[model samples]
Target: MSAPAREVRDVARAALAWASGRRADFALGEDALAADGQVDRSWKPLGELAQVCATVTRHTPPGDPLHARAADLLAFAWRQTGEGELFLRLQRLEPFATYPLEVYAALAAAGFRHPAYEAATATVARTRGWRLTEQEPTRRLGVLHAEERGGIHRDEPREPALRRTWLGGLPEPWTFERSAGYALTHVVFHLTDWGRAAGGVPGDLTDYLAHWLPPWIDTCLDARMWDLACELLAVAASVPGLPGDTVPDDAWARVAAAQDASGALPEEGDAGDPAAYFAHHYHSTLMAAFAAALTAGQGVPV
Candidate 1:
């Protein structure tokens, strides 16, 4: 393999090792509590873990130990609770928030088939409406999640036009502003299904990302926003016709360097105290693993 590909594979292997070791936490629900003492009383932890495992398995070859482990873990998590209970808990926690929908979408993408997920999503659509179609691009990615993962399909023929308008309204002259960078990455994620469904992204939006993504990745790296930087790597991996080899040599390297020996990458650039390790690092490490898997699997047909 080429140097960059090899680097991504190495990082992916390390992340898989780390994630596999956390199976106990995942199984026993210990990963549900945040460092701030806020417990994820909903299905967020299981959903997130399922998403990570699904994404990893998608890029991994069959018979690969990591792939089999991820699949097994996903099944285990699914069996722990029913979709109806999870959705009901999520509704009680935040009925109007977009996160529940996103979580459901991730589960669906991972091949966790549940009628309750579809029913809950449909109910939310009927009650909450398709805010993603009407709202700003940055705020409505969860809606895109609903659409892409078979949660709620919009029947409007003007969908492409709507996408164009939304893409056009995004703040231009992208800077190192942390929130903006984060939003841009999410915009790309919504457009590309976190790099797994790049073909569906509109051409203009894809072109826009192609132009601005490289410099934005550099800027985020310079600012020590490692989490956002990894997200940008995911965006790069998603753009079609964009050369797989064009990914910056150091992008994966920087994230890998920040990873603890235990396999967690910090939210920012530094690992915080031990007390906050799972809360601060879990999502970032997951994103890094996702980026690494996506990058390493590049050039192979999806």
Candidate 2:
């Protein structure tokens, strides 16, 4: 392997190691069951952990160290969800809430099935309440993906949902901003099922992404938006034959340099309070691991 490729793989490995070490910090709180209490702090992090670990397991061949690390992490995360029982309870607690199913989908995709939860969601999926629920285009796509993984038939066709997104318009390149950047990355993510289905990205959108994604990556890096930049990098890797290298080695080097000794990546230029480290840096660290894992799938499996 070339030096750059190996370095990128190291980034993936280190980031995953950091995440696995901090698995306990991802626990849900007492308020998690309350309607006012949300999953953003607790369930969100665990779900992100599950999602990235599953993605790593998906891209890496079995028996590889990275695959094993990710698998172990996935198992730990599944246990955190009470072996999928928490989702069933969450569904019963909030029948109309989609986050439980959203979080459940990641585990579900990685060979972790919850029959009771799936069965309950299947019945809910047929209800008018679930069908007519309003979500922004990106979230709508997420729900569809969750439904697919949860064994609930999709409430809406994906194509229309795709077109409704900010990235769907193929808007003026100059109009891109912070929120748009994230929205665009997620649009690509959901379209490709977190890079598992590259063909899900349309030819036109793929071409557009190929042409424009590099600058967006560079832009994020320039602003030190490591989390979103890594996310954008994953989008680039998700597209097949995405022309020249989507992120130049130096950019990858910058990302690697930004990584802490423990393998966690900061969301911005500097790591903030140590006490709040997980809250501030978990997502970006997860993104780095995710990008490296997906990129590693391109040539030699990492």
After superposition, candidate 1 runs with Cα above 4 Å error: 24-42, 88-98, 128-136, 147-150, 156-170, 174-176, 243-246, 300-302
Model 1, range 109-170, lDDT digits (tens) per residue?
87766676566666766653444446664555546565558457765443543454434454
- What clash pairs does model 2 have? none
lDDT (Cα, tens digit) per residue for candidate 2, span 201-258: 8888888888888888898999999999999889888888687767765877899999
Return model 2's CA RMSD, one decimal. 1.3
> Any idea what lDDT model 2 has?
0.87
Q: What is the lDDT for 102 in model 1? A: 66
Residue pairs with colliding backbones in model 1 are none
Candidate 2, residue 194: how far the Cα is off, in Å: 1.0
Candidate 2, residue 120: the lDDT equals 91
**lDDT at 228, model 2:** 92
Worst ten-residue run, lDDT, model 1? 30-39
